[model samples]
Structure formats: C-alpha cells, structure tokens
Target: MNFKELRDLFIREGAEFYNQEEASALFYRTLDQLLGWSRTKAVTSLDKYIEASDLPKYLEVLEKLKSGQPIQYIFQETWFYGFPFKVNSGVLIPRPETEELVHWIIETLKGQNGGSLLDIGTGSGCIAVALKKSLDGFQVSALDVSVDALEVAQYNAAMNKVVVNFIEADILAYSGTESFDLIVSNPPYIKEDEKPKMHENVLAHEPHRALFVSSENPLIFYKAIADFALVHLNPQGLLFFEINEYLGKETVEMLELKGFKRVTLKSDMQGKDRMVSCSI
Candidate 1:
C-alpha cells in the first residue's frame, strides 16, 4: 500500500479510538521510524509503496494505541529540550513543562560562573544532562532512588554525549558530604487526592511514584530538598524546582521556612505556576 493508503487505513480503523489527526500522525511517525525518513521526506514521497510484510507491524502498533499506550513509549524514544532521549516504562517520560523548567534554569544562570550542580530525583537524567550540555565549566551530578531508572538515565547521558555523575540514593535519606553551587529537582509533587483529577494518559502510563506525594504531606520532597539545600548548598547558591501548579504558594512557603532568600515562583507557558527558584 502507498503512504496515502496506509494513512487512510489507520484513520478508518482506529479513528474512533484515537482522533483522526493523532492516528494519522502516528502512522507517519511509525513509518518514519521504520524507514528513517524525515516527516517532509515521508509525506512528500507518498507515491512510495509499503511492502506487504510491513502491514502487520503497522496494525500491531495501531492496536496498541487503541489500548491507550502512549505514542512516545510506542516509538521508544522522545525529544526533550531539543535532545533525543530514550524512554521506557522504567522512567517517567520527559515532559514539555519540565523542558520549560530546564530553559528557566539555563536563562537564570546565564553569564554566571558554573560550579557544582545536583539534580535530585533525576529520572532519565533529563534536567542534569540538559544543564551540563548547556552550561560551561559546570560539575553535574544526578541522584535517583531507583536503580532501574538510573540505568536508563545513564544510558541517556551516554547517548547525549554529556557526562553526569549518576548516584543511586533516595534524596530524602541521603547524607551529603559536599555542598553544591546549585540544586534542582522535579520531584514527585502530585498529591494522592489529586490523582483522580489528572488525565488518564498520565495516571495510567506514567510511573506513579514519580508523580505522587502522600496526601498528608504534599510538600514532602520540597521540604526534604529545602532542608538539604539549607545545609548542603553553598552560600549564595540557588535552588530550583518544578512544582505542582496547584501548590506554588506552599512551595514558596516551604522555602521561606527553610530561610531560603529571594524565592521566586514562575509560571509555565500555560500560565500555571509550575516552577520556583530560590537562593540561600
């Protein structure tokens, strides 16, 4: 079948489960993966016909989508902060909001001397790796409790050709011997009570431990990190977090209680308060 025919087939068969546009896009994305073609190349070359043997793979992917698997997982890779990163069930997928957080970190630290930087809960090492790639003369370390997540993160670090110190330790329980010039985290902040309100795409596909905090203490990671920063961050060092949009005020308060100065809460592109930066 030609590209146009396969696109039509996906839309006709899976359009009810996935929207027309999304189903169509999925078709092209899968074809691009199989053929290693750019989108423009793939679409403009519609006259090229697909082999009969490739039909089964296309149908299989469509059925998986019908069952609600995320397209990124289906593709087994995703682009984050303009870098290609591998992802799977072991780690939470890198998100656009988190990209904004990374962008904010880069912009905030612009023209500044780079020293030691640490990322807590460094799933896939996205934040740590992105920072190391963007900043000069910076020492970067990333920590995560899950060994499996760390493995994926290390692979991503190597793939991106950026060196990041990957440490396996629970940030909450870690004893720090070295102070850092900057510390950043995008820790679990979604409260259990708020889970029902989140989209199924997130609650179902993403790792829950990376998404949620106990309802009794929605600010657990924030408090832990703040306390750590108080003792482990160098004087005049900065702390950054990608916060729960619903609890920006609480995050700011947590930093203030820890005596972090110049606490600033910033909104993401959607105008939700999603990040906080504070200085010691």
Candidate 2:
C-alpha cells in the first residue's frame, strides 16, 4: 500500500499497542526513512501503490511494533543534539531530558578554560560528543563499563566528527591517573522495583544494565560517582548528574555530603527534578 494506507492500517490494527497519534507518527516516520521519500511527496501520492517486494519489510516492522519494540531500535539510529547517533540493544536510546542535561553542561563549561571533562556511562557517546562538538576548547573523555556500548559510542564519536577519548572501564572500579574539571553522568538511576512502572517500549527493548539500579541500593552509581569526583575533580570543578525524578533531593544531599559546594537541582521541560549539579 501507499503511505496513507499503511498509516491507516497501523492506526486501526495497532490501537491496542500504541495510541492513534503515536502509531501514526511511527508508521509515517518509518515509511519516510525506509523508502527515502519526503513527507510532502508521500502525502500527495497517498493513492499510489507500493510494490509487493516492499510489503514484507512493512509487515515485519509492524510486527515488531506490535510487540512493543521501540521504533528507534528498528531504525538503528536516532537524532540527538541535532546529530545522528547509532543505537542498538547494547545502549539506551537518547532521551529529550538527557539532551537538556547535556545542554546545561555545555552552557556551564563554554567560557571555562583548558580543563578536562569526563562523562560517566557514556552510552552511545551522545553527551560527550555533543559537549566536545560545542566546546572545542575543552578536553573531553568518556568511560563506560560495557565494551559493546563503547564500540557504538566510538563509532558515534567518529560519525559526529568530534574527538572524545573513550575508555572501557566501570566507573565503580575505575582508577585513573587524571583529574577532571567537570564530571557528568546519566547513570542507571531507575530502581528495580520501578521497572513495572515504566513503559513497555523501554522495559522490553532497552539494555537492563543501562536502565536499572538495584532497588536495595538506589544510589549505588551516584554514591560511587560522587566519591570518585571528590578525589578526581579539581577544586571548584563541577559534578553533574541526570537523576531519577524520585530521588532529586537525596542526590543533591549526597553531593553536598561529599564536600561539594553550590549544589543545585534543576528540572527538565516536564518540570521533574531531573538534573543535579555541584562543584568541589
């Protein structure tokens, strides 16, 4: 079928799986990308017939969607910070809230001079690449525990034409030689008990290690990162985290207890307390 027919079919048959608007958007976006057709052109040619050979690909995508797989995974890439980033089962899909976190760091470090910046859990290297791209004057490096995630991150760094030093090490177990001017992380802040509360799209497709923290120790990564920063960050250097909305106050408190000064908690566009920044 043509673009309009496929979208209509998706909306009707996939209503139980996705809302009308979501299904419509996913179907059209997928069609545009798979067929390399402009939306305007596809709209005007709604009545045109699609080839029989393309039907299998359409049906396969629909089946995956019906099973609650995220469309970004099907596409194998996502746009973040206005750049195309490769993603897969090994990494979490970039979120709008995280983009806000990256923007905050970019603004915070723009005028600062010749100091190294470290990004923890740099899945897909979206934040690290974006920061280096925006602030060419600063030294940027990123580390991840998963080698698979680092491979994708490295590819993304190359794809974006940004220089980000990538390290394959768990931040929890890492011992490095250098100190940083800034340390930023968007770690696995979701507690295990909160998994059932998440959308099927996330729980079903995203990497568990990249999305979860133990319910018994919700601040595990945060505590480790904060302690690491206390020793690894220069005096007056900043520590930033994209936090779980439920634990904003606790995160800020943790940072303060680590001897960080000027702790600040900020909300994202949805007004949830999603970011916390502090200085050593």
Candidate 3:
C-alpha cells in the first residue's frame, strides 16, 4: 500500500482507540521517526510506496498503540527541552510542565553558577542533565531509589553529552554529607486513588514507583526532599518541586512548617498549581 493509504488507515483505525488529533500526531511522528518522512513529504508524496520490510514493524507498533500502549514507550525515546532522552517502562515520560520547571531554574540562575545542584528522584535524569547542559559552571548530580531507573537516567545523561553524578538511594534514607546550592525534584506525587483519573495508557505503560504516592500522605517525597534540603542545602540554597495540582496548598504549608523561606507555588501553562520553589 501507499503512504496515503497507510495514513488513512491510521486515522480510521486509531480513531477507535484515541482522539483524531492524537491518533494523527502519533501516526505521523512514528512514521517520521521510522522512515525519516516528514508529514509534508508524506502528504506531497501520497503515492510513495510503503517498504515491504518496514510495514511489519509499523503494523506491530500500531497494534500496541491500539492496545493502549504509549507511543513514547513503543519508540523508547522522547524529546525534553529540545534534547532527546532514552526512555522505557522504567522511567516516567518527561512532561512539558517539567520543562517549565527546568526553565524556571535556568532562568533563576542565568548569571550565576559554580555551585552544586541535586535532582532527587531524577528519573531519566532529565532535570539534572538538562540543568548541566544549560548551566555548565554548576556541578549536577541525580539520585533515584530504583537502580533500573538510574540506568536510564545515566544513559540519557551520556546521550545528551552532559556529565551528571547518578546516585542510587531512597530520598528518605539519603545520608551523604554533600551539599548543594539548589535541590530539585519531580518525584512521584500522584496519589494512589488518582489512578482512576489518569489515562489508561499511562496507568498501563509507566512505572508505578515513578508515578504514585500514598493518598494519606500525598507529600511523601516532597516532605523527604524538603527535610533533606534542610540538612544538605547550603545557606540560601533553593529547593524546587514539580507538585501535585490538588495538593498545592498543603505542599506549600509543609515547606513553610519545615521552616523554608520564600515559599512560592506556580502554575503550569494550564493554570493549575504544578510547581513550587523555596529557599532556606
């Protein structure tokens, strides 16, 4: 079959599982990645023949998508902050809102550096590596409880040509004397019960350890990281968190009760409280 036919097939079949725009975007992006055919080229060369060898792989991926697998998992890579990250079932797919958090950190430190920064629960090393790439003068390190997740983070650091010290340790048990000028985390903040509100693809494909926290104590990671910051952060050091939207007020209260100063909660592009920053 020709390219147009394949595109039509995706629109028709994928609509059964996903929305029209989502299905089209996934199909075109997968095609571009697999065959180096841009959407414009696919459109202009409507009659371009599908390769005999490539069709099988495309069909298989489409089947997986129909089965509610995330496209990023099928591809095993995603772009964050204009850089590529290798990802799989072990890591949470990087979100655009987290990019905003990174941008805020970079903007906050635009003219200053030569200090250390730590990314707690740094899945895929996205924050740590991205910070290193943007702030070459700063030392960057990342820690995660899951060694498997750390492996993906380390690989992404290498792929992005940034050096980040990767540590395997639970945030609750971190005991290093090393201090940092900044500490940041996008830790698992989704409560266990919120799973029903999430898309089936996310629930099925993403690692639960990288996505959930207890409903009773939704700020579990935040509290641990904040406590760690109290001990390990240099004077005037800042702490940043990508937070749960529903618990923004509670998160801010926890940080303040922990004696953190200048506590601030910021919303994402969608205007939901999604990030917090403070200093001690």
Candidate 4:
C-alpha cells in the first residue's frame, strides 16, 4: 500500500478509539516511527508505496493502537526533555508535565557549579538522566523498587551517555545514609478513585505502582519522601516534587508541617498546581 492508503487505514482504524484529529496525528507519528518519514515527507510522498516488509509492521501497530496500547509502548521508546529514553509496561512513560518539572530544576540550579541530586522512584530514569545531562559536575542517583524498571532506567542512562547511580529499594523502607544537595520525585500520586478518570491506555499499560496511591492516603509517597528529605537533605538543601494537581494545598501544608521552609507550589503550562519546591 502507498502512503495515502496507509494513512487512510490508520485514520479509519484508529478512529474507533480516538477522535479524527488524534487518529490522524497517530497516523503521521506511526509513519514517522516505522518509515523514518517526517510529516512533510509523508505529505509530499503520499503516493510513495510502503515497502511490503514495512506494511505488516504498520498493520501490527494499528492493531495495538486499536487495543488501546500507547504508541510509546508500541515503539518501546519516547522523547523527554529533548532526549530519548526507552520505556515499557514495566515503567511509567515520562509525561510532558514531568519535563516542566525537569526544566524547573535546571532553571533553579542554572548557575550552580555542582551538587548532588537524588531522584526517587526513578521509573525510566528520565528526570535523573535529563538533569545529569543538563547540569555539569552534578552527581546524580536514582532509586526504584522494581527490578524491571531499574533495568530499563539503567539502560536509558547508558544510552544517554550519562552516569547515574541506580538503587533498588522501596523508598518507604529505604535507609540510606547518603545526603544530597537536592532531591526530586514525581512519585505515584493519583488516588485509587481517580483511575476511572484516566485514559484506558494509561490505566491498562502503565505500571500501577508508579501511578497510584490509596484514596484514603493519597499523599503517602509525598509524606515519606518529605520525611526522608528531612533526614538526608544537606543544610538548606532543596526538594522538588511533581505533584497531583488536586492535592497541591494539602501537599504544601504537609511539607510545611514537616518543617520544610519556603514551600512554593507551582503550576504547569495548564495552570494547574502540579509541582512544588522547598528547602530545609
């Protein structure tokens, strides 16, 4: 089939699960991934025939997309903070909001010569790797509980040619003696009841441990990380979190009660309270 035929196939098939615009976008993205064609090229070469070998791969991707599997998982890769990282069902796909959080950290430490930073629950190691790549002379460490997730994270770090210390430990039970100049986390903050509001692809493909918390105790990870920061942060060290938009006030209050000073809640591009930064 030619490019137009392939595009028509994807749009028609993908429309069952997504709107026209999304389906079209998915078609172009698939073409880019499978054929290495830019959108401009795809448009200009609409009559170009898809190789027989490549057609089956496109069909398989369409089937998965129809099944509500995210394209990132279909390709086993994603771009974050302008850097590509490997992803799978074993780890959460890094979101654009998390990129804002990374940019925030980079901006805050822009002039600093060097400092140690820890990324808790570093699924895919996007934040740790991105920060390490951006910051010169900074020692970066990432901790995750899942061996599968850690393996992916480690591979991503090496793929990006950055060294990040990966630790396999549950943050709740971790008792490391190391201290850091800055600590950041984008831990699971979605309440159990909120799952129904999320897209089926995310709920189905993303790791639950990296996306959810009990509704009764939605801030569980935040509290634990805050307590850990209180003990392990250097004097006046900084702490940052990519938080749930709905629980910003409660999170800020909890941090304040825990003796974190200068607690500042910030919103993402969407104007929702999605990040917080503080120092102790």
Cα lDDT of all candidates, in order? 0.88, 0.89, 0.90, 0.94
Pairs of colliding residues, candidate 1? none
Tens digits of per-residue lDDT, candidate 1, 1-280, equal: 7888878887888765578888888888887787887889878988888789877887788777777777788887998998988888778999899999999989988998769999999998889988999998899999999998999899999999988998899988998798899999999998999988876767778889898989899999889888888899998999999999999998898788878899999999999999999999
Q: On residues 1-280, what C-alpha lDDT tens digit does candidate 4 reach at each position?
A: 8988887888888876798889888889987887798999888998988789768888998999999999999999999999999999999989999999999999999999999999999999999999999999999999999999999999999999999999999999998999999999999999999988999888888999899999999999999999999999999899999999999999999999999999999999999999999999
In candidate 4, how many Å is residue 254 off? Answer: 0.3
- TM-score-sorted candidate list, best first: 4, 3, 2, 1
Best by TM-score: 4
Worst window of 10 by summed lDDT in candidate 4: 8-17
Question: Deviation in angstroms for 262 in model 4?
Answer: 0.5
User: lDDT per residue, candidate 3, 182-263, as tens digits?
Assistant: 9999999999999999988898888998999889988888988998999999999999999999999999999999999999
TM-score per candidate, chains pooled? 0.94, 0.96, 0.97, 0.98
Give the per-residue lDDT digits (tens) of candidate 2, residues 28-139. Answer: 7877878877777667877888899888898899888888888889888899989899999999999999999999988887677677899999999999998888875889
Task: Single out the weakest 10-residue window by summed lDDT for candidate 3.
Answer: 8-17
Q: On a 0 to 1 TM-score scale, where does candidate 1 land against the true structure?
A: 0.94
- Itemize residue pairs with steric clashes in candidate 4: none
Order the numbered candidates by lDDT, best leading: 4, 3, 2, 1
- The model with the greater lDDT, 3 or 4, is 4
Model 2 lDDT at residue 248: 93
Clashing residue pairs in candidate 3 (N, C-alpha, C atoms within 3 angstroms)? none
